[model samples]
Target: MFRYFLNRLGQGVIVLLVLFTITFFLVHALPAGPFQTEKAIPEHIKERMEAYYGLDKPLGVQYVKRLGTLGTADLGASLRLEGRDVSEIISQAFPVSLQLGLVAMGLAICIGIPLGVVAAWKKNTILDYSAMALAMIGICIPAFVIGPVLADRFGQQWQALPAMGWSPLSPSYWLLPAFTLGLVSAAYLSRLTRAGMLETLNQDFVRTARAKGVPEGQILVRHCLRGGLIPAVAYIGPAFAGIISGSLVIESVFAIPGLGTHFVKAIEFGDEPVLTGIGLLFGILIILANIGTDILGAWLNPRLRSSR
Candidate 1:
């Protein structure tokens, strides 16, 4: 297990290195510098600015220099937000994003799993059909659309919750945005869980459990559910990675201040520092989440444990 973890960590480091290299050149390759929009800055001043940001250095030299900073946790200042370090900005914003993502994932799991379980247990009955129909609708409707509709119906018309803006640890702020971010995930999770459950129920072990006179509830919970849950657990890492990165449209529509909003703005303004900071942060999150899931799965399943 320790070796497996170390291997995953090493892979994560390599992936981050690749991302850093690509991002460095890609940003530089853009037709303009951070100060390019300022047509008024004279040639000498522009040259000085480029030199100050190490833009004057060769691509390989800049890459090497930046790699040194990365090694020491120095992500540098935002080109757009002068005097502000990229890490500082991320620190302030990440908690809000993390909170939103957690709320969304919580909602997804709470609703999706039970719905899926009921659907599978009920088979082709009304409960199954209704649950599947709901899942289909959730999959069809985009987060952006859902955000406004929820805001309008639940916030504007009903005044049930705050329609926009993040409030630190505020329950009111959690309702709309969390639901919007979670709805699609819930749909997918439900479908996956139902499929996995159905497949596991038909397996020989489940049949053997029944033949051995195991209680139906115990068989379902201890055996069928455990096997069925694996697929949902597998999907959870990426689903969470998506939520943590923020659904750009949902963040925008709902006016949630998060990494997603920051990323889009950074892209629009061509703010390389902020963009790269967020991109690297999100990439790290994805890699970590997957590794964590793998480790957890390995621990849970004897097959994986033995194979490893």
Candidate 2:
């Protein structure tokens, strides 16, 4: 296990390096620097700002310096955020993103697993058809579309939920956004769970348990459901990373002051330092999520454990 963890950590480091290199070149290649905007600054002030942020250095030199900072756990500073340290900005923002993502994941698991289980147990019935249909809608309509519709119907017309804006740790603020995100994700997970559960139910162990006079409910829960969860768990990692990264679009739509919104604004304004910081943070998130998925997979599957 230690060896496996070390190997994954090493690979994550390599992935981070590649991301940094790509982000550096991409930011530098933009037509305008961070100082350039619709309203131009005085030439002297722009020059001094460039020099202070190392934007005046050759791209290669700036790349090396920025890369070196990562070794010492330094994320530099955000030019767009008025001299706030890059790490500080990320630290402040990560928790909000994390909270949103976690809430969505929890909701997805709660709703998706049960929907799937019920659908599988009642295959070919109304319940199964309804669950599958709902899942299809989820897959077809993304959260971006659902968010506005939900706000309009639930918030605007009904005036039950808040229309927009984040209120930080307030359930009222997070409830709509989190549900919008989770519901869309859960739709796909529900289908996957239903399929996996159906397959597991057909397996010989399930049959043997039934033959041995195991209670139907006990067989379904102890044997079929547990086995089925393996596949759903496999998807959780990538789904989680996607939610975190994709939150940018949702946050923009909802006017939430999360990392997603901050990152989006930075990109739009060509804020190199802020954009790079956000990119690096997102890249690390993806890598770590993938690593965590691998570890969890090995733990859940004895075959994987033995092979490793």
Candidate 3:
């Protein structure tokens, strides 16, 4: 297990390195510098700004210099936000994004799993159809559309929640955004879970358990559930990472101050440090989530454990 973990970690590091390399090259290759929009500024001032940012150096030199700061607190100053260090900005913003992501993931799991279970248990019934129908609607609707609809219904029309802005102290700020972020995930999970459960329930072991007079509840909970949940478990890690990265849209809708807001802005302004910092941070999250899921999968399946 220890050796497997180390191997996964090494692979994760390589993935991050590749992600950063691609991001670095793409951003650097953009036609204009951060100061390019300042048309009224003197040529000497632009030259000085370029030199100050080490943009005057050869691409190779700049790449080497930037590589030296990987995994460190020094992410350089923000081109868009003067006097602000990129690392500091990330530290402040990421927690909010992480919190939102976690909540959204929780909602997805809590809602999706039960819907799936019921759909599977009642396979051909009205209840099953209803649950699956709901899941389909959720899957069809995008988060951007859902966000506004939720805000309009729950916030503006109903006056039950805040329409925009974020506050760590108030759970109200989280509701609309969390739901919008989670809805589609919940929909996907529901279908995955139902499929897994149906497959597991059809297995010979389930029949054997039933023949031995194992209680239906016991079979469902202990035997079926364990096997039934495999696909859902595997989907969870990448799903959570998707939820986090996908928050960029929700953040814009809710006006929540998180990494997503800065992420979009970084591209608009060519803020390299912020973009790279966020890229690496999100890469770490995605990599760690996948590793954790692999560990969980190993624990669940003897085949996976032995293979690892």
Candidate 4:
């Protein structure tokens, strides 16, 4: 297990390195600098600004300097937000995103798993069809669309919740945004879980369990659920990363202040450092999530444990 973990960690490091390199170059390759816009600036002021940010240095030198900072766990100051460091910005913004993501993930697991299990257990029935139909609607509709409609229905018409903005002290602030982010993922998970459960149910071990007169509930929970959940477990890593990063449209619609909002502004303003910092953070989250998924997968599947 130790060796397996180390191997996965090493792979994750390599993936992050590749992602960082690509993002660094791509951001640099953009046509204009962070200061350049429709208005013209004096040449000397531009030169000084470039020198101040070390943008006057060659791209190779800048890359190496940034790499060194990364090695030392220093994200440096934000070019766009004067006097603010990237890490500090991330620290302030990420918690809101993290809270939202966790809530969404919980919603997905709680609702999706039961719906899927019931659908699979009662296949070819009205319950199965109704659950699948709802899942399909979730899959088809984007969060941007769902968010406003929910806001209007619940927030405007019914006055059940606020239409926009988030409040850390209040749980009510979490519901609308969390639900919008989770709905699509819940649909995907339900389908994936149903498929996995159906496949597990058909396996020879399941038949043997039934033949041996194991209680159906025990067989389903003890024998089948672990295997049936493998796919959903695997999917959680990347999906969770995506959720925690904050959806651009959802954030915009809800007026939530998260890393994603900064990310979008950074792009528009050509704030390469902010963009790169956020991108690196995203890569790290994804890599860590996948590593966790691998560990969980091994624990759930004896074949994986032995193979590793």
Candidate 5:
């Protein structure tokens, strides 16, 4: 297991390096300065600014410098936001994104798994049809549309929750945004769960368990659920990375000060450091999540552990 973990970690490092290299060049290739302003600065001032940020250096030199900074775990300062480091911005924003993501993921797992299990168990029934139809609707509707409609209905028309903004101190502030993200994720999870459950239920082991007169619920829970959850576990890794990065539209609609908001602003303003920092962070999160998924998958499937 230690050797396996080391191998995965090495692979993750290689992936991050590749991701950083591509993003660095692509961001620099864009046709503008990171410090572009509505009012033009004097040429000398601009030159000084460029030199201050080491943008005056050759591209290769800048690239090497960026790698050096990354080696020391320094994200450097945000070009657009005076005196603010990329690390500081990320530190401030990530907690909100994490909270929102955790709530959403929890809701998705809690609701989607049960719905999918029931639908699979009662295949060809009204309950199955209704659950699937709901999942379809959830999948078809985009988060941007759902978020505004939810805000309007619950925040404006009904006055059940605030229309926008997040308050960490208040649990009420969490519900709308969490639901907006969770419902969409749940749709995908439910379908995957149902498919996995159906396949597992038809397996030889499941047949043997039934033949041996195992209680139906115990067979479903103990014998089938672990295998049935494999697909969902696979999906959850990347899905979770996406959620923790924050939903762009959901954050905008809810006026949440999360990583997604910073990411968008960084792009719009051509803040290269911030953009690359967030991209690097995202890559790290995705790689870590995948590693976790692999570990969990091995635990759930004894065959995987033996093969490893």
Candidate 6:
């Protein structure tokens, strides 16, 4: 188990390096200069601005310099935002994205796992059909549409919750955004979990447990569940990649100040530092999520646990 974890961790590091390298070059390759706008600035002004931000340096020198800063965990200065560092902006914004993602995934897990269990337990029944129907609806609907509809029903018409804006003190602010993100994730999880649980429940171990006179609940939760939930757990890593991408739309709709919002703005302005920083930050998160998923899968499967 320990050896497997170390292997995963090593692979994660390699993935991060590749991600960072790609982000660096891609951002630099944009056609629009970071300091340029619709109206052209004076040549001298542009040169001074470029030099000020060290854009005057050769690409190799700039990459090496940025790489050095990255080694020290500095994300360099934001070319689009005056007197701001990408690291500073992200430090302020990421907590909001993190909170939103966690709540969204929590909702997915809570709703998806049980719904899947019951659906698998009573396969092909009305309950199974209904649950899958809802899951399909969720998967079909885009978050952009859902956010507005939810805001209207709950915030505008019903007056039960705030429509937009965010505050750590208010759980109400998180609901629409979190739900918008979670609903799609829940749909995927339900499908995956149901499939995994259905397979595990029919396996030899489950049959042996039943033959041993194990209580149905005990067999379902203790023996089969660990194996069943592995897919759901593995899904979390990719699910978060979706969740964060979804948050891009959700953040704009709900006026949430998060890394997603910055991410969108960075692209619009071609803010290299901000774009690279947020990209790598997201890359790190997804990498870590995947590593965690691998570790969890190993824990649930003895065959994996015994392997390096």
Overall local distance difference test of candidate 2? 0.83
As a whole number from 0 to 100, the lDDT of residue 245 in candidate 2 is 81
lDDT (C-alpha, whole model) for all candidates: 0.85, 0.83, 0.90, 0.87, 0.88, 0.87
Candidate 2 lDDT by residue in tens digits, 46-78: 999889888898878988888888788887777
Task: Give the per-residue lDDT of model 4 (tens digit) for 36-88.
Answer: 87899899998998899899999999999998998898988888888999999
Which lDDT value does model 3 have at 215?
Answer: 95
Candidate 4 — worst ten consecutive residues by lDDT sum?
243-252
RMSD over all Cα atoms, model 3: 1.6
How does residue 294 of candidate 4 score in lDDT?
Answer: 85
Task: Write candidate 6's Cα lDDT for 1-308 as tens digits.
Answer: 67766887798778877887887788888897787799889999999988988889998998889888888988888887899988899889888988999899999988888888888988999999998999999999998999999999999999999998999878999888999999988998898889999999999989999999999999889988988988898998878876976687799998999987888878888888898888777777777788777877887886876665
Ranking by lDDT: 3, 5, 4, 6, 1, 2
Clashes (backbone N, CA, C under 3 Å), per candidate, total 0, 0, 0, 0, 0, 0
Best by TM-score: 3
Q: Which residue pairs in model 1 clash with each other?
A: none
lDDT of 5 by residue, 211-276 (tens): 999999998899889999998888888888877765766888899999889888887777888988
Q: For model 5, which pairs clash? A: none
TM-score for candidate 1: 0.92
Prediction 1 global C-alpha lDDT: 0.85
Q: Name model 2 segments beyond 4 Å from true.
A: none
RMSD to the hidden true structure, all candidates: 2.0, 1.6, 1.6, 1.7, 1.6, 1.9
Clash pairs detected, candidate 3: none
**Cα error of candidate 4 at position 130, Å:** 1.6
- Report the C-alpha lDDT of model 3 over 1-308, residue by residue, as the tens digit: 78989988999889988988899889988887677775577989989998988989998898888888775657788998989999899989999998999999999999999899889989999988999999999999999999999898999998999999999889999988998999998998999999999999999999999999999889989998888888889999999999999998799988999998999988888889889889988898889889989988887887998776
Scored against the true structure, residue 149 in model 2 reaches a CA lDDT of: 89
Of 1 and 4, the candidate ahead on lDDT is 4
Candidate 4 residue runs with Cα over 4 Å from true position: 38-40
Residue 80 deviation, candidate 3, in Å? Answer: 1.3
Q: What's the C-alpha lDDT at position 236 in model 5? A: 87
